[model samples]
Target: MPASTPRPVGASGPELHDHLTCVAAPATWLSPPDGRLAGGPGGLYVADRRVLSRLVVTLDGAEPEPRDAETLGADRVRFTAARGALAVERVRTVRHDGGTERITMRNDGDGIATVTFEVTAAADLAQISDVKAGDPPPPETPLRDGAVLTGPDGYEVRLEGRTEAALVLAPGDRFTTTLTVRAAPPPVPGFRPAPPDGPPPWARTPLTVRSADPRLDALVAQGVADLGALLLADEGDLYCAAGSPWYLTLFGRDALWAARLALPLGHEPAAGTLRTLARHQGTGHDPVTEEEPGKIPHELRPAYAPGRLPPVYYGSVDATALFVVTLAEAWHWGMPAEEVEALLPAAERALAWLGTFEEFVSYRGSAERLPNQGWKDSSDGIQHLDGTCATPPIALSEVQAYAYQAAMLGADLLEAYGRDGDRHRSWARGLAARFRARFWLEEGYPAIALDGTGAPVDGLASNAGHLLGTGLLDRDEEARVARRLGELNSGWGLRTLTAEAAGYDPLSYHRGSVWPHDTAIAMLGLSRTGHREQAAELARGLIAVAPAFGHRLPELFGGQARRDGAAPVPYPPACRPQAWSAAVSPALVTVLFGLHRDATTGQVSATPLPGFGPMTVTGVRAGGRTLTFTTEDGAPASD
Candidate 1:
């Protein structure tokens, strides 16, 4: 095996570990005899800290241990141990694979054993791996609840040239393969190596972004810069990572979504995400292309043989049109009209996809799914309690609006560029008209329709969040929408759903947590439509309370109702410094500052707030050129 491919592409190889290796035992727990690592639905785990680094193995008569460990794509675990003159390195790679691990020996040394690995899964995962001893690794063990069926072929090495047969395991505990095994007779030094360096955790709270907290600021800046470096760019545009451990690469929707603000902060690398996502724009509805003639791609990568997720995933109902959405927003921030013009076909095709998505994505039962395509796209994401989700023939509610808004904008861009102006405007007008007629609910307001089936997946879900931000809802409707949101937007911020709704749960990830970024979008939407009081109320409340959190707003927090002493509950497992988490704050600034740039003529406007005085944002670029803005100290009449 090639030495490069031996260890996994992004694995902790023979070196000082990066961010993924190190683990912190609570300062309270004295180091146990051996750290325990197990594999389960949660993913890979570690037992001992810095216990094992490189596990080398050699047959009794073999020369030296093979330095290369074969690559196992999915989940796996390993332990390092030595028996007699021979050394054993055990590993378990599970498929939806599961199990427990056990090791015993009779040989020259007496010491400890260690293991390392992580579990990767889409969602409903449950598996564990640990050390054990028996004829078989014990299937009935609670540790074996998710044990693998028919594990890998077992290998047995006599302990005292003793013991029975070797047990089989998955990357499952597939229990951690013991690192070093010891027999009674005598003692040789057992493997006691350092752990790999893992990604550092956020500074002990009080994380700040300004120089006043210089030490912590440098740390935060590095975190910010690393996230920036992680951007996988194509051509000139960039895509953001929501891909996670596996696909943490670029994603079309991720790019455009994050790009909405990337450029504003002088994030130049994001330019690559912009250009790349646009280049793969759809041109026709070949199931393979998911490409509807001109829709921008949802994913971009090389080596995607014909029909693979590498180059495309039509599963997303909004990426393409949003590609145009980002294009327009980019121009608004000073990228060139020519650049916008360049993506014209992509924009037009994206507009075309508005109808196509309804046609193909109707979960009515069309195609299986594509990864990283939708918000709920973990493997079991499509389905509810039932096995199968509505299906591609199904049209989700928010997607409908995303399509409408993205299409309408694409058309507006077309008209602005003087390219098929009449046709584009007509399409834009038609979509607006259609959206009002079809999506608006008579009783439940906009019935949060799951699709054309007239199914109401109704809730005051944050799903309706984009509605306000996009300017898709007009003044009259915006008022109604704002009024409706009051119930969901408690003092803290907008809840994912109203507490009264069935889908609502203060702790539910999608059901009702208060996502700061999501709340910010809703706030911007309210502010956009001149709902100043409502927007300001939200911003002030959120900003005022957020600093209690050390000024770095986390991705989200529990949306539970507030009493006096309750500290906002941080979303349990949210990633800090997430691409959008950082970006949203700036958008909040823009909303608060009332900053708007007209890409067409390159005019910058700043309407300061009552207490807020002159604000200057230098190196501000729009239409592909940089410009500066200075406001007089005096507040404008409105401000």
Candidate 2:
């Protein structure tokens, strides 16, 4: 299948925020507004496929009216509903391979009540891409198992109690029934979930945050919970998946960025992520999946068809560089020297791949490749200022920055690990010089990228903001870039593109949307470049909007200019509880405190900024020790 425009957000109606998503890593369930895994945008999903599409409940042929719903944990929820004289309590639990829903009905009327219950269930083994595009799935096929609805190739929905039953209950009497849905593949090796008690072996270090602002406090709390729930363990290795419902698998870029932002938590997860990705590093040139020797993959599927799309896709140019960058950062943040040493070869390969590039790292995927392979992978993501799509083999300004950072950091790592890296240092210096001369645009901001033909594709985007701390831009260049990015800020956060840009669309995913994680990175950049006031302002705006979206930021939202008293508009189909979005809270805290660690020196320190108010973050694990940040004495303190 060739890269095509993503289908529009069709008749599924407006973006739904009321729904709850319970994820058990690779296995997740998204419920509709009614709290049932029924037809619309809710189902049991595993291995990137929606297994059970329809699971509706009715009492005496009438839909149950939802009264109250609350998520108990990442994998459990409680729902209260009423249908006529019956009151119902539904507890849904998402497990590793399947889900169980227990329903308890109580007669609410004074007299005895007799009612019939019917659960209409179906399974359509539809790919996640199809589901996200609102493509109608094939018709469900009834299976041979009694009360089971299944599709071909083992997509099954099994029921224990009868699907249709009649029960009589006296006033205050209760009746309970449980239906189980096992969503597994056709006996594929290495696809099964790990044991419940013993998940992939990673340190369960607890990190906590608190602030004087209640909203900010709540946001941090929710973010911690979300990150914990989204952690997945595969073959004794734990890593954070991008998000649920659609993306419940390993993504190289998302995982790398998430791990980088999470340095305050610990280095174990970051170390695990590097090892997990290195295990699948490309070793040959396969254009179909964009494999090249030493390149890290863009994404990894749970299972793969041999002749079809490979299980691992190495289309991203940044992920490889990022992998090297993360390894260096993790080493600085206290990952064991031996563990970091083990990954030095992979880092060398990644750097060697970058050396082969003439100007900057570029994607080599053919027409069948993803239209836009950067962080903004949507169809129209990489368009010119005039709204035309940028041609492929594009050298993104940020990728150059990433490459520059990677080279410098890779050189440091090589030196620390007893390898020759003067060449890497020389290469980084030359690349930074090239970037400064080539990427700057006449509009006072950097062009988004150089198109396939080496022509600049102009856009005042947030991409240049990433250059601040990367050492790619000099002090004055960083200041100018920061000032331009500040103008594009919507008060809510930095928009992806300036509103005045020809291709800007507030609702578009990458064109004009405000992504919390993206803005967080830019804010970090601002802090690094001595723009403390601007960084604090952006932090305050993010805190203000946190409450509107349940204190857990979505993947991205509309880039509507912030007003004095208006809320940020939600982008339809934006992934909530996304890994990077969940990580923004901590990333902001990291920038606000100006936290830094030197693994060689074993020193930790902080310089807190204003607008964050008086706050304390305890139990931050870094440098192989628990450190604390407090602002109780009118100034930030560290221990």
TM-score of each: 0.60, 0.92
* Best lDDT among the predictions, by candidate number: 2
Error of 2 at 303 (Å): 3.7
Quality of model 2 by C-alpha lDDT = 0.78
Q: List model 2 lDDT by residue over 360-438, tens digit each.
A: 7777886465777789777778888889989888888889988999999999889987898889888888887787788
Q: What would you estimate as the lDDT of candidate 1?
A: 0.45
Error of 2 at 231 (Å): 2.0
lDDT value, residue 411 of candidate 1: 60
Off by over 4 Å in 1: 1-230, 243-247, 266-270, 283-292, 299-312, 355-392, 450-452, 469-471, 541-554, 611-619, 623-639
- Best TM-score among the predictions, by candidate number: 2
Tens-digit lDDT track for model 1 on 314-376?
456566656767776765676655655666665666665555542323332124445325554
Q: What is the C-alpha RMSD of each candidate to the true structure, in Å?
A: 15.0, 3.9
Deviation in Å, model 1, residue 533 alpha carbon: 2.4
